[model samples]
Target: MAAEIRLSPCLNDNFGYLVHDASTGATAAIDAPDAAPIRDTLQREGWTLTDILLTHHHGDHVGGVAALKEAYGCRVVAPHDRTAALPLVDLRVAQGDVVKVGSLLARVLETPGHTLDHVVYVFDDDKVVFTGDTLFSLGCGRLFEGSYPMMWDSLLKLRALPDDMLMYCGHEYTAANVKFALTIEPTNPALLARAAEVTELRSAGQPTIPVRLGVEKSANVFLRADDPAVAAGVRLKGADPIAVFTELRERKNKF
Candidate 1:
């Protein structure tokens, strides 16, 4: 059976995802930046919310869990740390746990960089991943709690995934991310083409999310830290991948 996904904008720039398993009608909201959109999306589609899957403990991500649970009686799944501030978690998953979203199964990858409790969901059969603030199109999340090494390791986990995976991140920062990426590897034609496409998409008032991982694998600066061209751009020509990644991330933070 195929899985269905719905993308909606929440808060000012954050994104909310609604995924459903067609065979079982098991619907889930990946993260609840705001309740109104998630609530309305489920209502508008007439799909019962069965689960609220959290990627981190950030308020923007978990803020709507309580209201949605009260409205739909959905079970909540989240990482097993810093969850005291979140609503009661029905399942506290660690790395390598398989979560059933209806008939679909999602494997959890603990990716702590933006936040200490960050995790991304990979539904292998569906060729989709829900990356809540871990990785974005042409960029990665800002380091707020974890260190450069931790974030670097987390990114490698994402990099090793199949190239066909479609990434659905937590925010609408593609245009900005692409801009900063150009400063890192301005000579990359793939990045240039992608940036142009993103510019056009945003100009048309379209959402530039659920980006292709294949494209990101080549264009995202954070994901290409080992590339000689990228290392050269940062003036770290023969540096280690971790060091290059560290420099790239710091440059982006200041970019």
Candidate 2:
């Protein structure tokens, strides 16, 4: 059976997701930003929360885990957290690990940069990925606990995924991200069209997410750091892709 996915906007700009399987009545929340919205979503969908899959140990992502777990007695899965900042974890996963919510299997890919223990869930059968804070719509997470090179490598791993995959990120920052992207690839037709679309979507108060990886590969500047045009935009022509990427990130920090 096909998986049912729901997106819940929570806590200012954070996004919470629930992936449900009908065959087994198993539902997993990708990240619990807050308990109220997720609880409401669960109640509305008539789906019981059986699992809480965390991508990292960030407070915003795990804040609701405890409450939800207490309410549903669900298992909590998370990446290895040496800091002990997160709540109780029933399972600690790493790269290449497969986690199951009912019969739905999600492969874990370690993607540090947003945080040292960050990971993303790729549901191959569903052609969907939950890219926590590691990747945004047209941008990437800021280098907080990881270096530029580390983050770049992580991004490469994601970029290598199939183009048709549908990507869901942790925040609704597409409008701002696209605005920054325009600074880098102002003349790129794909980005221009995407920007217009984002503008219209935001004007209607709609969420700009669940974008296809193929579309992001064409317009996301962070994913295009290897392109010569991107290098030129940052006045780093003929420079290595990593150098271009670093320059772009630094500029974005200020932007």
Candidate 3:
């Protein structure tokens, strides 16, 4: 049976994911930003929480782990490096480690740009990746604990994945990101079209996440590090490639 993923909104616009294996009814939660919503969602779906996948140690990302574990007695799986601060961790995983939710297996990808402990979960068979704060719909996370180059390298690793892979980022920041892209590439047809689409979606109060990786490669300025036009734009602005990406991200942060 195929894996089923459900998106649950928690703590403002942050998303918490519930991934389940349809065959055995085993389930895992990806980043518990808040416990109340997670508790309510589990009850509504009639699914038991078997494990907690912690991507990082941020309060918004790990705040609910204690409460959820106390309520459900589920194992907490987090990065080995961050377990010292994450007291609820039951399984400490690192890059290349595999964790299971029923029949589905997710490979751990260390992506430490948003935070030094950040890790992404990729379910190859399901063609989906849960990129906590490392990657966003059209933006990347702020380099809180890592440098520009570190963040850029992390993003490059993700860009190497198959284009068809679905990117399930942590936040819903597509509209704002597209607006920033317009400042850098005002004449880009793809960016223009995507901006319009994001406007409509936001107006309708719909989420613009789980955007296809292929779509991001084409239109996402952060992911277009090697594009000649983008490089030229950076040169014209008297900035290097990394500086260009950082400047773009900073603009987005303010947008």
Question: Of models 2 and 3, which has the larger TM-score?
Answer: 2
Residue-pair clashes per candidate: 0, 0, 0
Cα lDDT of model 2 by residue, 20-65, tens digit: 9999999999989999999999999999999999998888999999
lDDT of 3 by residue, 160-223 (tens): 8889999898888788788777777788787788788889889998888777898888788898
Question: Where in model 1 is the C-alpha error above 4 Å?
Answer: 82-84
**lDDT at residue 39 of model 2 (Cα atoms):** 95
**Candidate 3 stretches greater than 4 Å from native:** 235-240, 253-255
Candidates 1 and 2, the one with greater lDDT: 2
> Stretches of candidate 2 above 4 Å error?
none
TM-score of each: 0.97, 0.98, 0.94
